[model samples]
Target: MLPPLSEKELDRLEDLLITYGNDYSVLNLAELNGFFTALASSPTTVMPEQWLPAVAGGKVPKFKKPAHEEAYTALMLRYASQVAEELGDDVDHFEPLFEESEGEEGSVIIMEEWCFGYMRGTQVAGWAELPPEQDQLLKAISLHGLEDNFELLDQMSEADIQACVPQVTEAARRLYRYHRLQD
Candidate 1:
């Protein structure tokens, strides 16, 4: 199995995205990882060319540092491998982007981004004629992306929001599995 992403790696990636002047959205490494996994699971064939532009939030800005670009490429390649392994069910280890350090509010933000990225990836991948159930799941995820949960965040207790994390993560996983099953 491939190793999990280190905090340093995520920090480096974030720095690279900033240097590249990301303007489309605020996406963390975890979200990117989720996006790539969704792309891999998608029924449509997605090329690196398509993914690069989509993740760049529409444009692929030139990297300020050549080394950072190379690192980013390597990381993407790893994500690709992860998709393959996941589809085969040959790997079991996985980590959601949000963990303990992110806390409830941070977790909500990251998960929303992650779902948004997955939705974007599926669209870019040209996912075709999804099964009814999967299509419904896609719609739900899209809603999650568009919803202004921040205001609600205050109304809900931290523990209550955090409690929803597992369910949200499971939904993503189920969506991923649903696509694979259709294959």
Candidate 2:
């Protein structure tokens, strides 16, 4: 099995992404984690060719060196593979790579980018209308990820948002398990 990305490698990958030209909509590390998780857990396979462009904000970036491009691709594939292995080994322990910030109460999770990435993964996979239960699970993710729900989220209190955290986490796990069962 391929090894997971080390912390240094992850930082390097993040650096590469940040430097990938201002014109491109490259995903940050958190979003990339979410995107890869979604793809790994997707009911159907999404080819790298299809999702790779999506990661670069819908267009592939031009690297100064072919070696740089190769390295970038390799890092991404390895990270995605790591996510898949984690999920495959045990969905129950799967954790989203969410960022956290100090709030008045404590550390608050910043799930927006991750959720958005997951939603993008679903889009890339061309997910069809799911059954009611599965759709509900997907909705848990969309509630936090999609900008369209900003107004709704705005009205929610911090406590409410916090409450949704476990729901979102469980939703991801259940979604993965649900799809795996079908396989």
Q: Pick by lDDT: which candidate is best?
A: 2
- Summarize candidate 2's per-residue lDDT along 65-173 as a digit string, tens digits: 9988988999988988998899999888888988899999999998887898889888888888889999999999999989899999999999999898888888888
* Candidate 2, position 107, lDDT: 96
lDDT on C-alpha atoms for all candidate structures: 0.64, 0.86
Query: TM-score of predicted model 1?
Result: 0.73
Give the TM-scores of the predictions, in the order they appear: 0.73, 0.94
Name the runs in model 2 displaced over 4 angstroms: 21-24
How many angstroms is residue 140 displaced in model 2 relative to the true structure, after the best TM-score fit? Answer: 0.6
The candidate that wins on TM-score is 2
